[model samples]
Structure formats: C-alpha cells, structure tokens
Target: MGNILNSVILESILLDEGETLYKQNEASAYDLADDNGYAYHKVAAWVKGKDGTKYIKTASIASRAQLGKVNVSVTGKGAAGLYEIDSEFYTVGENVPDPESIRNNSYCYSEVNNVLVSNAIYRSGFANLDFRLSTGLPLKQYFNNDGELNEATIQKVKNSLKPLAKTAVSENPPIMREHLIYAESLSAFVDWMVDENGEMVNKVSNGVLVVDVGGGTTDISFINSANEIYMPGSDTVKTGVLDVFKKLKQYLSSAYEIDEEHIRVDMLDKALRTNKFTVRGESKDCEGLCNKAKQHVAKRLNNFIDELVTTTLDHIIFVGGGAEALREQLL
Candidate 1:
C-alpha cells in the first residue's frame, strides 16, 4: 500500500465481467479508533479482475450500487477506455489480486468542494442584511457566536431618537430599544443618514417620514427640529404584522362565532387576493374586517408613535414590514 495519511486505513479490490461475491459468517472486532474489523472465511461467487485474474479474496465484502459511468484502463494497454459500471468494492487493503488497479481518488476531491460552497452561501446572506440597513453604504459587520449582531456594532444608535423632535406632536415619544432584530438595523441606517453632530437635518426636522414595509413588522420614526436626539426622551414602537392577523382572527371568532382557523385562512387568502381584507360576514363586510384588523394594528402603532413623538425632545421615523406596506396610504 502507498504511504497512507496518519491512522487512515486504505483498501483496494478488483472485479471482472459477470462476477459476483458475497460474505459469510464473520466475527467483528473494534479498535481504539472506533472502527470495526471483521474476519471472514467463506465466499459465495467466483470473481475476476480487469486483467482477467481470478481469486477468492475475502468473504467480508459489501455490495456496490452503480451511480453512473466511469473510465477504466486495461493492463498493457496504451489508451484508457470508458467503463459502464459506476463503482467497485474491495475487501483487502492496497495490494489487489488483479494487475490493473482502479484508482478511487475522485471521492476525496468532491467532498471538500461541497463544504466550501455551503459556507460561502451562509456568509453572503448575513452580509446582505447589513448592506440593506446601510442603504447601500458598506458598514462594519459584526456577528456573535449565535450569528446575532452586537448592540455596540450599531452606528449612531442614539441618533435614531432624533425623529421624536416636533412642536405640533401631541403625544410623548416611545422609548427605543437597540436590540430588536431587523428593526434596529434599519433604524440605525436611517439615523446614520439624518443625524449629523447630534442634530436633525433641516428637511427631516419639518417633514413626516413613511418607511417602506417588510414581511414581519413595520417601523416608524419621526423627527422635528428644536429637538436634538440627546436632549431628552423619545418614544419608539416595534409592532409585528402577525400580531394584527391574530387579533383579526380573534375578533372574527368572537363577533360572528366563526371558526378561527377558517377565518384566518380566509383572511389570509383574501388579503393575498385583494391585497386588502374586504370580505363581509353576517356581522361585517370585508372592508370593515380588513380595516378593523389594520386599524387595530395601526392604533397600537399610532399610540406608540404619539408617545414617542410627544415625549421626545426631535423627528419621527417609521420602519418595519407593516410600515413599508402602508407607506402609500400614509403618504
């Protein structure tokens, strides 16, 4: 056998046309490497190698299933030729009874390539999220052991509060948290753009902003002049879209005594079909139901926004999946 790698054991075998082999009674033995060894003394069929050599070999042989075609070489031949069978199995290590040996080096090459591709895809997805938050600007990326972002990695987190500054606002701003999943990253992105030296930009200081929505939730941020982010309190609210669907389901069940699962399915289907819930039941029309659901979610969001704006010392920013969807409505 060729010089093998470390403690690795190598095996080689050869079989010819129309040959078969089987294993009989064998005793198993285990080594410190946890690899099992077997002893066999019986054979079931005559076998031959590509070189036309015949041998009984060993009975501790396993079956081989054909995956596809491969090329083989014959002893004392000048050119390689294609072989129909995909794979061959052997019972002995290294030295084979046949003079023409089939090199089985392809297996090692394919396994290593698979691992490289999988790791590349995983890292690419993580980088995409960070780029989206930066609004096209490449930002420093950091990941924890669990692949979550560290709060400190967020740039201009305090500046996200700048949206709370406003004079006409009636309610206090909601308190902002820095560690929410996607929402926080988006907030940091906007804050980095609008806040400069702890002050809101002139345009942002006076105008209301509507954030494009996403899949799970919507984020909203508001800002007005006279309120710098660090000056005082600001409110920020994070609300999930799934919560609205759940509330709507509960309302339909309670008001019309309909089955919750059916209502949920219907509501989802209707929302998908019409992009709005406008179905009517014995108690309410689709429009009313959809509006009620949206409004229910909106009410909570508005309340949070109101608190966040009124209490804060700047502008307001809206973000998240829901906010993105309702941007046109708000505009």
Candidate 2:
C-alpha cells in the first residue's frame, strides 16, 4: 500500500489476466483521503509531452480543460454512463489532437488517461507509483429502474476496465493494478454515515435526498429512514450543467454573433460571473441575457425535481458542479 495523497486507497494488486473482477466497498470521505482521495473534473484533453508523446491532461479545475487550446472543443462529456461496446473513437480536439481518445469511456484508454493525469498532477511529481484504483458510476448506471443492481452494466464496466489496469497509457503513466467501482451518489451519502475516525455515525436516522447536478448528468437519490438507498427513487437525469452552458452559448451566438464553439468554457464562465463579455476589445453588459439563459435551464430542471421532492424526506442536499452555477435559481 502507498501513502494516501488523494481520496483513494492505493494498494497494489496485479491480477491474473483472467482475474479482472472488482470488489465493491462503501468508502467514506475520511477513508477517501486516508486512501488518497483527490477530486478532479471529468474533463480530459489531449496534449503533447516534452518528447512529443501524446498524453491526456485532466484538470482538477475546469479552466485547465482548455489550457493550451485557442478554442475549447466540447467533446467526451455527456457520453458517460451509457457506454456502448464498440471501437468508435471520439475526437478530443479539432486542432492538434491525440490519437487515443477524448471520449469519457470508462472501458477505454480515456479512463486510464484521466487517472494517469490525476496521479501526475497531484502526486507532486513522485514517480514509481503502484496503486490499485477505484472509481464510481452515476445512480442510474449503477442501478436499474427496479432498484436492483444493473448487473450487466456493472459487470461490463468492471470487465472492460480490468485489462487496462496494467495497460500503459502514457510514456511514464503511473503503475495501476486492480480497482473498485462504487455508486457515485451513494459514495456521497457514505460521507455522512462515517465519523472522523472512519467509524459509523448515528446521524442518518431520517430520510435524506441527494441531488447531484453535474456537468453531464443530474442524479437524484433518496435514503430512507433505515439508512438504505431507496432504489426506486434513485435515478440519473440527463439534464446537467452542460445544458446550462449550451443555453448560455446559444445566447452568446445569437445575440453577439459569436460562434458557439468559439465561446470557450472559460470565456462563458467569465461572462456568467461578471455579466459582461468582450467584443472588439470593448466590454459589453449581458446581465439580463445571462440570467435569462440560466433561468430557462433552471426551469426545466425544476420541473423534473418537482416530482422527486416529497413530504417524506427529512433533508434535501444539493450537490455537483452545476449546483453552484444555478444556485440562485435552484435553491
């Protein structure tokens, strides 16, 4: 085992070629940090290393996603959770691309690259890493509509990822071994279920609802009074922050005559925060238009959340990347 840097338990487990099975564990935030838990954006972009080798760069901060690119090409996101078993490759960038992938496919090198990028960036340049891995799935992807395990999808996800454990992604990628995959939403709940000593807590005596509005998907999950996940009420919705970005980008396109692709993620963020944008070197106010765009997406999300909110829930928690962006409208 290695020292915990992020929220991951870094143990080495070189599996036999035929032994690619994964074991699931309900890990808490304390356990996460004790095991090297590090939070990173789901976005991964392709860039060249010093030796001209291709590498996938993942950013803990959203701005890093477009670090070197003149234009931020939207790719790989929203393709998550419903991975198709095929040989299709998604383009990472239209300019100076990487051959491997930009697709957010857990079953492919893209997933491996994301992990590698994390290890490289957050590891403080410490090399010779030999850590086993653990990842997660959204609520709908982890469970079926009947509240039972999505056996087929889970198995497929694990099986496909097994071979990549030892597969090299970069010239000096971290040494990865076997790994675990947990339910993304449930992982959040486990944080509340454990104490600072990594022991169980008694705080979860009532029902709680978790709303995770992410960049690509919004997951709604419920925990009953018994501290069990109400599978029937747990699901992943397709509406997320990316949709909000689309509406914002659309407004920028139509109102400012700026191409949607050229807006870039960072530029849009600045515009949203300051309610102003630059055109021909002059700052222009877009406060009203920006609010209108966010409100439109928030309205749609409210319609879906209305059905999920009920009188039985004792506490409601809002989370994920998008939650703060639409904070005023959502809360």
Each prediction's Cα lDDT score? Answer: 0.32, 0.52
> Which has the greatest lDDT?
2
**Candidate 2 — which pairs collide?**
6-36, 6-37, 7-32, 7-36, 7-37, 7-38, 8-35, 8-36, 8-37
Give lDDT tens digits, candidate 1, residues 1-331.
1222111111222223444222222331110000000111111123344555554432222111112222233453221211111132112211121212111222112221111111111111111111111111011122233434435433333243222211111122222222122333334435545663556553434434333233233334333443223212232233445555566677766766667755534344345235454335332354455567777776766665555445432334554345543443332
TM, every model: 0.34, 0.63
Model 1 CA RMSD to the hidden true structure, in angstroms: 28.1
What are the runs in model 2 whose C-alpha is more than 4 Å off?
1-59, 62-127, 159-172, 199-202
- Candidate 2 RMSD to the correct structure: 11.5
**lDDT for predicted candidate 2 compared with the true structure:** 0.52
- How would you encode candidate 2's per-residue C-alpha lDDT over 27-83 as one tens digit per residue? 311011111111223422233445555443443322122112133224632321111
